[model samples]
Target: MSVISDNNDFSFKKNERLYHRNEIQELFKKGSSFYLYPFKVIYIADPFEAKVNPQQILISVPKRKFKKAPDRNFIKRQVREAYRQHKILIDPEKLNRNLRIAYIYTSDKKMPSDVLTKKLKKTLERLHQEFTV
Candidate 1:
């Protein structure tokens, strides 16, 4: 199979792709954004300016609601899987363009894995369209 066909072959070059606390806090002061969705997915996509890499795309679940590591971890894993599956849909050429996307779970409860997967795909589709537009 061609390399592109292998999702595992995609190079997520760095572990620091996700913004650190200081970076997110600093983004509020320095960076501006184009609205992608309803909820404010506050992000600093600057680090991606250097290369066509997915420096980090964060998906945060609420802490107050889950109140347990297992629940949070499960939801995080589901989110990561959904991203992994759909990420290749977005081109590497365009990767650096929309680099820092922070997809926060604004909902109240932890949705089922299937439900989250569906929502994630829909959101990614919208992002692809908007990014290309």
Candidate 2:
């Protein structure tokens, strides 16, 4: 992950989250994906005429895999926290276009927070390499 000198750069604001239904559907329908253990990452790069955050992300923990609401919520929280901390790894300026990404939790078992953070770091690193190329 790339280091940011300013601490405020780490915040995960509402605008940085991908939550609209239409956007979610488009990302899943048209995006390319890769699996990295617990996360199935789908992403697309598209230019937008209107100014927007360079990247926005959606995180999902399936109901089928996690039968209870709390379990699903817990995983989502972990994923979101990890993303918020490590997002600086991807430099938005270099992307030069809007990037939409979805992270679907695929593992049936809940992962420890430390392991989840490590995996998320690797996932973001991979994404950084993919876009920077």
Best by lDDT: 2
lDDT by residue (23-52, candidate 1, tens digit) is 566655665444432223545444345444
lDDT by residue (1-133, candidate 2, tens digit) is 9676654487788998998999999999999999999999999888643477678999999999999999999999999999998987876666566788899999999999999999999999998888778
- Per-prediction TM-score, please? 0.69, 0.89
lDDT of 2: 0.88
Worst 10 residues of 2 by lDDT: 2-11
lDDT of 1: 0.61
Reference-based lDDT, residue 70, model 1: 89
Distance from true position, residue 65, model 1, in Å?
Answer: 1.5
Please count the clashing residue pairs in each candidate, in the order shown: 1, 0
